[model samples]
Target chain A: MYMVAFLGPNASYTHQAARDRFNQDTCVLSPQVTIEDVFQQVQSRVAKFGVVPFENSTNGSVVFTLDLFADIKSRHPDIVVCGEAYVDVHHCLLGRGAARLTDTSLSSKTDSPTSSGQATPTSKVPYPKTPAVKPVVPVKHVKKLYSHPQAWGQCRDFLSTYLKGVERQDVSSTSRAAELVAEDQSGSSAAISSAIAAEVHGLDVLARNIEDSADNKTRFFILKRTDCLEHQPMHRGAKVVDDDQNSFKSLVSFTVNHEDPGSLADSLAVFKSYKLNLTSINTRPSGLVPWNYIFFIEFKGRRENDGATGAVNAALRDLNNVAKCWRWLGSWESEL
Target chain B: MYMVAFLGPNASYTHQAARDRFNQDTCVLSPQVTIEDVFQQVQSRVAKFGVVPFENSTNGSVVFTLDLFADIKSRHPDIVVCGEAYVDVHHCLLGRGAARLTDTSLSSKTDSPTSSGQATPTSKVPYPKTPAVKPVVPVKHVKKLYSHPQAWGQCRDFLSTYLKGVERQDVSSTSRAAELVAEDQSGSSAAISSAIAAEVHGLDVLARNIEDSADNKTRFFILKRTDCLEHQPMHRGAKVVDDDQNSFKSLVSFTVNHEDPGSLADSLAVFKSYKLNLTSINTRPSGLVPWNYIFFIEFKGRRENDGATGAVNAALRDLNNVAKCWRWLGSWESEL
Candidate 1:
């Protein structure tokens, strides 16, 4: 049986992604932590493979995931990204009851049970506890909004304009927010999370399509510990069929050592020379040193099958002296 | 009196940033919402200037602020960044009481009140009325861990390793977490927040330096609706006329239409031709369109000064058709 691991709390988006990419028959492990933990799990053979979010069309790159890749590549030379998954994110407002309870004892004496009774009259402001699972909050009693940082930021305009003067809180994951609101007896707080999270936690949907952008999608990766499937096809149709199947995409990350003029031009020349179509290119601080950057590049072909692979390999080999480090992250299609 | 606005709940890092950069006696307004609110406040003449975080060394660009600039330039043409400030961020774990509490409830049903009486002889759980903060039970018992998304993310390693199975809840702001934790009588909850927040809410410090990276610092912008002062040099022998006067580093943001491949190249060439040294460059998805991007660029020169002003004007004139929009953000030195 294939062992699959994902960043989780059972029903996290990453878990959904892993299930979507890997066969349902595969044994899946959900680690309640980060993508780094997913990598570690795979590295330690706790799982054969792991799924982690790498980027979002809306939020650019997931820096932590990239950092994890860098750390893993530096320490463990065997791990490689074997598959990719693209999941469209539609954030929903999730809460347990109809309406959120506002005026939750703003006074400092709330800790005292005696004082809590005094604040209940003011704190008991009932929000309409509509049981419908609509994604949109028609009436704006949303005083506090909970979401992942990226989700919160993507919906900044809507929250600022509609939920004006309301509180916007950031959580580790959207699923966590959904869990919080679902368990919250107080109806005043709502979480901006996934529809699945809302379904799992039985949260009331306040608002739908709250994101400023409609095409909000996140990309995830399934990385293997031993580069077991490195010889897979580069561009095998859009679908995959196997016992433990996953769609594939090319993932490459490299460091540009020099910041001089035309440094980017010379680097792009390698891709251009190989006729490779780059889907995305993002530069983020290396975290290892100040001002230095790590450029993550996503493209159309897998690292093993396409002719572009040999070209890229040759280019990296030639540039490796000046380039800090370069490697293939993963190529499998992500399940979502 | 120069009026300045910033994101706040009082004593927030943004508030300290504005105070450090602007006039010592400058009238300050702490808006409870987004940086866009600050821009609107300035444009509406409610405040003469605004301060907002624009970037961080560890986190890269503050894309939300950059998006706001794009909106401000298109909708309200009056406001611009007049100065910049850089501030260090230090996160702390806080709770209520003196010594940290290790375990608060013996059973999961601590809310039942009656469950508190049915204590098992082997369990070493502290009574609910311990009066001091303690390490919450693992994820199995933890109801919630409150904190800002960034704080939670920066401390992901610690949370994953130590708190492992706990439910991580997101709050609108770290300060809000402290407020909630102060009011929560439940012993299974705690908050990761700033020391200042802990002090305000009368909570205790549970942890220190929880961030994965030690060199975390955020850069803030001091913005205004109208130009308030002309840039001047601070010579070593210059006479000090007013002790309340301030100096700031100017930040300007503009976009080059990427509809054409040469557009960005043409626009960037103007900066090169004029010999302007750009300090930073970051790109974000334009809210107006799905794939379109807006680039936020920072330079060292002051737009208020003739040399810098002339260069910017020349660049704009040369790249008029390719230029989407441009604005001066603000300038201010951050307090150490």
Candidate 2:
């Protein structure tokens, strides 16, 4: 059985994405504290693949992971971006389960990510009988809500309406928030976390889908060490990245060659000539020099393909005229 | 008295920087739980100015602050980036002061930034009677160390050599780490925090300057409300940012016109044509379009200057050929 790891305390969004993307029965999904730890585990051969968050719909791209990719490309041969997965992030207010589930009819117009099979309760506290589509939070009783900072930002509307004036404490991770509430078990304290965290930590789900945006989702990248790509079995639940699939994506990191005007535009021109569609673009410090930067670009197409291979070479040649250094991070099939 | 706020729990690096950059006697300095809180306080006019971490020598830019700048630009007219300050970070192992500063001679080759006026120690525990230059930590006596994640990262070298295998826990801030140690008052518990924390919390500096890097430093940006910039007084420890200073920096955010070939290069060319020396460049999701990004470029010279104003107008005119949108965040003197 292959071992896979994700950023954790077990119930983090990364953990949920890992479980959803990889086979939990065949692969041992371990959790590491930070994103770098996930990368290190894959590098050290302790895990065959590591899953890390790449971006979020509401909060935007995860720059740390992107910066790490830029850093690793400079040192290691290059990590392989094996596959991609999208996890619909559904946040819940987790409590002690002491209060019986209430307001079963208060479900979102959009259902929770996982529980279509069962009708889930939207809130534990009773509310005024209004035929509103959205659930109303019981503002007075919720004295405090604990969660990651991102969670607080995502749930601002719910917080303003239901938990307004309530003290919110930011923990390191959502899972940590659940863990804290589980340990404390105070009446007024609850956590905004993944529904799985409530299960893992033996907490109660007071409300479901509490995020301000119904379309909250996170994208994750499955990465493997460059040296051990071949002879490796498919990561339990991950799909094979086929070159024929239009879903394939190639990630490239490069730096501008000159401080001249339009230099950055020149490097990006290669992608246009290749007829590539960029999915994301990011810039991070080179770390070698103060104020220097490495640009990361993700475009649709596999490097292994005939058309892509030629485009890759052509782009590299053209970019060399305007960029100091460039490296292909990897190509993977990311199914939307 | 002007009110100034910083990210803190009293002795956080932001708090230290705020105190050093603003007059303590007149300005009422306050501690905030999050960086956003500082920004919000200043934006809401609750505080005349706020100080926030901008970049770290080792960790690179504090992206949150940068992202916040991009965000606020679209909403507010643009908060003025008034002045910059550099604080040399010095980490210390703090205990209850009950341990009797065992190795009074313990100190790193680099001392605390403010302790240069005093004699330095070279060891925390009783060592061989030799004139050693480096300070040593009594790792054998320490069972656990609490600190912010950044603190733990900065002090890895000391932890590995002297405190190998010791349990480490992450808190919100370094000051919180000291607060935890003070609350527990346990003989085996220590905290990696600022020297000022030990003094405020009545803890002893068991070991000083435990950070791995010798030149550990953090830079802070002083922020002010948009409407109040005209009548604003020079912050106590900060120099007035004259519009005419050659050290001025202009922060601009823009996006490529299209995914067409060389689009990004074309947008950057304006900088070169304008002869703007970009001191730093960053990229963030434009937030308007998925995967589309806004590039943040910080360059030497102010937007108000004759040369710079012409350059800005020229760059904007030239960039319109390739960029979708652009906004000048602010300009202020950032002397070396």
Candidate 3:
């Protein structure tokens, strides 16, 4: 039986993604932390496969996933690439009865016989009593804005415009924001979150598609133990059979000696000379030391591929002086 | 009187940053939107100075802020950078007394003088009297995780470890997630947000410092209309100015025509020829047709320096085809 792992409490999007990708009968494990843990679970054989988000259209790449690859590759040596999946995002507003402005009865208006025994005339204002649909006044009374960091960044333009100068708060998830707004009796606060959050928490969506850009999409990855799965070619135009195909990409993390001027250039030169396409690069300060930095890089080809495999090994050979804590992260095709 | 604009309702970090840089007497306007709007506010003379976050310690640079420089420079040619300020972030959890843990009082051990009032030994047990201290569990059970995208990204490792396989929801801000969590009475839902959010909506802190990194901070920019203020002298000391100096580094945005490989190299060569140290570089796909790309670059020197300014302009002139839109953003030194 295939065991699929995701970031969870059950109602999370990752869980939904996992369920959609795998069969319902497959056992799904919901951990309380991160995608890295899911990868670890699979590495430890606790789970057969793990699903995680790697990037989003509106927000760019998921840095943490890249960081995780950095961490894993440094420690593990055997993981390989598998597949890829793309998912569309649709945002909606859900809320309790109080937040709804349009009464359902008003939309479903139909003349019918009155319970009092008189024939109801079409002019008599249709069926169930229609509550007045009040115009949503743009009140200058908003005290706070709530949402996930990504959503906030995407809607930064809008928030700065309409809700300018309001208290902007960060939350765990959009759904949690909806929950808080729904529970609060005070109408001064609003949540900038997903429609599902509104539905779960029963909170009205005061705004829709408030993001600065509309091409919002997210990509998720399915990671397995490095030893468990071998590389397989899944991309079109590849002639390699399932047994010899390479599916996962290679990720590496290392640090350049801060004192060296050409350290970064030298490291990058290796890839360029090898004709390797570096997909992503990120730098973070080493918390333990002042002014020191660590770099994370993602390359297009996999370690199992002869060209990529040779370039990485060659780079390692030359980095005897500058590189520190190098590792190879596992590769797998994500099931979206 | 200088008027400073920021994203707000009130008590926003951006507002605080503005107030910290400019005097309290400087008229502050809260506009509820993006940094681009702040530039617009300054350009239109709605505000003399506008403040917006350009980067965070935990997150890298703010892409939108970088994108705005190109847009504003093309439309309003006069705006220039004046100063910068940095601020530290400390998030707290707050709520009403009803949401606080209940304190239990112990009986006095001393004997009373009156015979009717018998002395009782104090119990050794320290127990809370009210049930408020008990973990406020939800009703429904684990379903989803919610938070701002950045917050989620920051706390990704933790979330994946503990909440793996659960649904993940993204909101606009962390405060929104906290607000939503407060409204949820269900037993399963949880939010990864700030302590301040917990206080505002009367919610509990399920976790604290959930972010993977501890030194998380954000940087804000102070901008003025091109025609509003005179150019200030650039700070030339080896050490970068602290928050009090109100000094800032310059930001430049440009686009390289997609026709050739040497285009980007040529632009960089200009900077290198002038001995200019490039601090950072980020490239994004321009939404425009023809598959062009936008590049945001940050350098060590200020635009006010004649040699630095002349070199940049000369480079742009030499490779006219390489740069389609070249403009300098504000130069306020960051406060954090």
Candidate 4:
């Protein structure tokens, strides 16, 4: 049996990604509380493979995932991301079988998240209070919306157009939101969850595909211990490898030296001169230093490819001149 | 008098930073609930200036600060960061005057936050419970610990060495954490908060400067509306500009072309060729595209300086060849 770990609860997006990437029949999957746990479990050999969210089309990058790379590189250098999976995120408003919520219950905490994330500005002298929190007047129809905080951004249009002023209560997950509504047995409250979660929690689907944009998709990375990948223990590993033929892609994470200007440009020139097609480029805090950044770049072709091999060699050589540190995260075929 | 906004409460790190940056006699400061609100309030002219946390010496960058620049560039193109201040973060373990929490109250929700932020992970098939939540062998000494989530990282050694396995509860702010402990009135419960907060909330400091590092410092950015800066409505504007002694620094936020491997490198080359000293570099998701990044670079010298002016022009021109978008945030003297 193969053991895999992903950001969990059985009905989460990560779970869906894991099921899509790995066959459930032979895989024993575990859910980790945090992305760090997912990485830790894989590093500690508690699970052969780990699955974590990389980015969401609507909500944007899963920053902690990028931040964890610094920790992982320092502690667990033997692990690497070897595969990927994508899931179309469709949000459904799920509620209890009951019809309406009590007026008092509907009026949830009126305070909206005003702070961007960290510090809020304050004054010793009370100036004219700025119209900050839009006194969220509870809508008569939908009084409370229970969903993941990230869901609020995705269902913006639906919430404003249909259920304006509905108080949003952020929960652990969409599934948890469904559980909360189910447990509360409140008709007035609704949760934006997955259809699978609605069914699992025995909730009525109030609305389906309520996301503002249809292109909402989340990408997941399948990671494995470097040693496990080389030995190829499981039959599934070979199957996954066989799916992608001679064509493959690689991830290069590097930090450019701030002291040297154009150093990063020259390094990129190596890839340009070699005619490598880059699919994506992202930056994460090096975490080693306060403001320095580490760039994560995904490009077409495998390191083993003749042309790609030459580019990798030249880029590595040139990058040494411009980069403070660099690493080859992994080379894997895009299963997209 | 100039109106400024900062992160809430009278003694929060942001509040302290604001008081340090702006003259209290001439400035009326308003506390915003979130860092985002501070930016939004300043952009909308609700406040003439805003102060928000930029980075923590030990913890790392205030990522949303970088993320807000993306939103500000889109919504309020006229606002710019004008100044900065640094505040030393000193954490104290505070408790109620009543003293001593019951072992029961201390163990009240034994579930530790497994999720990094606010989410929890669950499994489809509940495996044999892996002794997840440690049965807190609640010692009569200390019942529980309450503090901001960030505190857990900073006081790692202290917690592991002294409060090993003591139940930890993550609150909104360290000050809020103190408030909670004070409200609990349980002598057993403790909060890691600022010394000022402990006094404000009427809590006793059980432990002072519990942070693992001695030099824990948080930097704050002072922002102002573009018109306010140019018009010099307040006497302070000229004073701020004059203090810089004709030497100022500028911030440029840009997104490199993914199609061009060396595009970012080339832009940096412009800075190098012009002999401009780059102060700091950070990157955040553009949000316009998933996983793609917009780079924020800080360099010494104002836009008017020949070397700085030439670098900005050359970088913009070269960047246009290989960038999707580019923006100049603002320039000011290094307050340090």
Candidate 5:
């Protein structure tokens, strides 16, 4: 049986994405401690596939994933991205015996900022003069909140509105936060975690979909060894469909001659010449020096058959002349 | 006294950078709980200046800082970056009653990776068959390691080689981690924090400069209200010397016409046309909609006098035609 690894203690967002992308009946799901562990598992052939978060719509790029890719040419060179999965990251406020928000009015009210389509900056007032509408859950009873650091940012509106000035403690994962809340004997702590984590840890969902953005989504990269793709087809149960732009996507990382003026522009010109639609661009510390950078460019194109005929291939060949160094990270079916 | 807000509980890397950039006798160093708090402090005019981390040499950009800028044109329009400070981040392992690293051999030994100059990927083996040299500290006594999540990635080699299988707990900041270790009654926890944090929290430095890269530096942006800059001069005693490049650096953020075929490339072409050297480029979710991005471009040029004569002014004028919308974030004396 094929084994798939994900960043998890279980029920984390990555775990949910892994389950969504693989058929449990055919593939055994394994939980790795860190994103690096997931990469190591695939690199060492311990797992046939690995799932790691690429970015969040609310937060930007997961720097850990990008940093790993920045050095891929030197380390874990055999791994390649095979597919992607998107998970709606709806967070819940979980606590021991906290009221399960049965009132639909609260969810709709809290989602007002999202519906207005304003990128609402966090309110200046921590406790905004206690809204006239009474909270279903007694937030004043809670003395501490627990979650991964990223969750605090995502739930900014909800937090500042109800639970501002409360002591917040960061844990390894949101699931771990839920676990800590479950173990707390004081009943004064709450956690921002997934509903599944609440169920696993036997905590009540005080609130649901508390994320400031209603459409908070996380993108995950499904990875596998490049050598294994010939025998192993795409995962059996992934539901990623080709959108209207039915084209393949490829990601490449490269460093231009920093000392030379216009070196970066010269490299970017190749993509335009190839008529490739650039989807995203990001930069990371090259790890070779303090200020030098490695740039990752994702563009719409195909790398099938690994030959020189494709536009992506041609652009890459042309890129070699302008870039001091470059590496093709992967090519996968486009989901945009 | 002038107040400078920073992201800290105190003794954090941000605090160190703030202390280095501001004279405490003239400017009061205030510790804000979060990066957002620091921004809000400046936006609310509660503080004359704010210090927030921009990027780390080992890790990349701090997304929180970038995300705040993603919506600056709408949210915090008055804030502008006036200067930047670089802090050499050397993490120390702090534990209550833990032996100080009196032996200098370990420091010299770990320096091998930095000296070799190869972007050293993490070793495959988690516990590499115990080294012949005895470790200075008793690793078996430690049950938990505490640090900010980013610190873990920076100290990967050291952690994997010596502290494999130890439980790691994430905290709000490295200083908070040190505080936790100092308060731990079990004496089984150690924290990765700054040397100043170890001294402040009354913890012994089990290890010094434990970060994988010898030159792990963090760059911080010194922010101030745009309106206040005209009345007051740069902070009392920031010793930012003009570098040999002797050019001014400006940061601009914009959203290109996504529907246009070559809108982004055309927008970038303006810099080349103006002969402005692009220093760095980054992208963050625009927050207006899912997958829509705001591009931040930092280039070496002058944007003084707020008129249309300068090359940067002319390029920005050209960019206005190509981009759907744009904002000039700031201009400051170049440090590079």
Candidate 6:
């Protein structure tokens, strides 16, 4: 079986996307500690494909992924984005299944105000509710909350209303948080994680879809080494159905002379001439100097025929002449 | 005194930039918990000015700051980027001054490999060589290394070479990491933080400039309320010297119909027509849908007069006509 690496211990949003994008039967899912690790795994040929979070609908670009792409020309030249998968990020509040808990619905919305005049709940006592039904922990009963730091901001509305004054701790990932909460002997600890994470760690889902935004989603890129593209079996979930499907999108990174007027516009104009519809544009620090940026442009286009100078090839050829330096990240089958 | 809010407890990189950009005697420094807190303070008029990290040479853009700018139109419409400051990020390994420590220089470079074949150090005993020297904790004795998540990547070389196998803990900020190490009763804990953070938290610097990159720098934006720009006294460090100095750069955010080909190119053409040199371009998720982006363009230009259709004003007018929607983020004097 081919190894498919993803950012995970287990049950992260990236893991979800990876599972959704690749066939588990033919590809063994390997969990990596970091996004860089995933790239390193693919670069070393330890994994046939690697998945990393690219962007979030609410949080914006994942800088780690963008920075890695920025250094693609020098560091991981053989690596290319092959496909993409998106996972709707629905955060869940998780706790020990056996813990005594209070129903948040039974608690009053307006708790007693602290000296600071904010509604700070001072009580940690679990108000027993539906004891005959099942033992579940209340958010108010939890003395501490654990999750990835990003989760706190995403679940601000749910947190402030339910668990005011609770100590929020940052873990390596949301899955790790659930794992920690599961290992905790004290019932007072809980975590903001995914429902799948709760299941993997054998914890109970205290709340579902606790994120502030309804449409929170994270996009992940499926990456593979360019030289190993051939002799690779198509994963069942991959969208590469045909060569002429007109469903391909290309990503190109380039730098322009900052001192030249309209240099950026001139580079972008090449896309117009090629009739490639522009979908997205982004920039990242070049790391060589302050204020220097590497611009990445994504557009609807066809993959270049090998040595044939196709439409994308023609555009990139023109772009290379216009840009100070350029690198084609990849042309992948667009999911949507 | 004008209140200047920054992302800080005391000595984060943002706090250092805030201090460097504003006169200490004329401005009262107020530390905020998060970047959003700094923006909220400025928007509520609690602070006249706010400082937040925009991008880092190593880490790319700070998504927290970018996401805030994405919603500037509806959330903080009055906030504007008035100035910018750059901070040289020099990380230091800090520990309790009273702790017994060893000199890392005396330790052997080659450590024992773990069962996994990775070179993981098995010993935590402090090798005391500098008995006559200052009491500095050795990295080998550190059971835990605390810092912001970004610092780990920045100091990868240093960490792998000197402090391999040390457990890393992520805190809210580097300064907060220093504060945690200071408060830790266990002498085994150390922190990777700023030099200023060590001084403020009464921790001894175990190592200096531990970051992997020599050119690692963070850029911060100095923000102010647009309505309060008139009566605002000239900050001693601000670069708003003259209106026609050609040092001004404006940041504008806009969106175009994705179905419309060459729409982005047309919007960018307006800058070229007005003779505005484009310096940088970026995009953030519009938050409305997946794949939809809000493009931000920064260029050399002057702020528009109240009623005069200046070069920038005319260019923006044209851009607005071409774009589906647009918002002028700010015009600020460029530091570089």
Each candidate structure's count of clashing pairs: 54, 23, 136, 24, 0, 0
**Runs in model 5 lying further than 4 Å from the true structure:** A98-123, A126-143, A184-188, A230-246, A305-307, B98-123, B126-141, B184-188, B229-246, B305-307
Best by lDDT: 5
| Candidate 1 vs 2: which has more DockQ | 2
Put down candidate 1 lDDT per residue, B1-336, tens digits, no spaces: 545678876657787676565554535455546666776777777777677887666666666677777773354567676555567777766664322344544233233322232223222122322212223322223357887666766665455444545677766677777788888765456788777777778876656666666677777766666545643112223434332212223455566554443444445555556555444556665655544556665543444444534765565566565567765555433232
The positional error of residue B310 in candidate 3, measured at the CA in angstroms, is: 4.3
Model 2, docking class: incorrect
Q: What is the interface RMSD of each candidate, in Å?
A: 5.3, 5.0, 6.4, 4.7, 1.3, 3.3
TM-score for chain A of every candidate model? 0.76, 0.83, 0.66, 0.80, 0.86, 0.85
Tell me how many residue pairs clash in candidate 4: 24
* Candidate 5 structure lDDT: 0.78
Query: Ten residues in a row with the worst lDDT in model 6 chain B?
Result: B125-134
Q: DockQ for all models, in order?
A: 0.16, 0.22, 0.10, 0.28, 0.54, 0.53
Better of 1 and 3 by DockQ: 1
Badly placed stretches (over 4 Å) of model 6 are A97-137, A230-246, A306-309, B97-137, B231-245, B304-307
TM-score of each prediction: 0.69, 0.77, 0.61, 0.78, 0.84, 0.86
> Which one wins on DockQ?
5
| Residue pairs of candidate 5 with colliding backbone atoms | none
* Cα lDDT, model 4, residue A10: 71
Model 6, position A60, has a per-residue lDDT of: 75
Which regions of candidate 1 fall more than 4 Å away from where they truly are?
A26-32, A72-79, A92-171, A177-195, A198-213, A230-250, A256-278, A299-302, A306-310, A314-336, B29-31, B92-146, B152-169, B177-214, B226-278, B299-336
Consecutive 10-residue window with the lowest summed lDDT within model 3 chain A: A128-137
lDDT for each residue of candidate 2 in A213-283, tens digit (9 for 90 to 100): 67778889988887765423344455555556356788888887545545665666677677776666776
Query: Candidate 2 residues B66-120, lDDT tens each?
Result: 7788773343344667767788898888874433534433322343432222222
Instruction: Assess candidate 1 and give its lDDT.
Output: 0.59
Instruction: Please report how far candidate 3 places residue B20 from its true position, in Å.
Output: 2.3
The alpha-carbon deviation from the true structure for residue B269 of candidate 5, after best TM-score superposition, in angstroms, is 1.8
lDDT of 6 by residue, B216-303 (tens): 8888898888887543344554444776626788888898998898899989989999899988787877878766888888889866
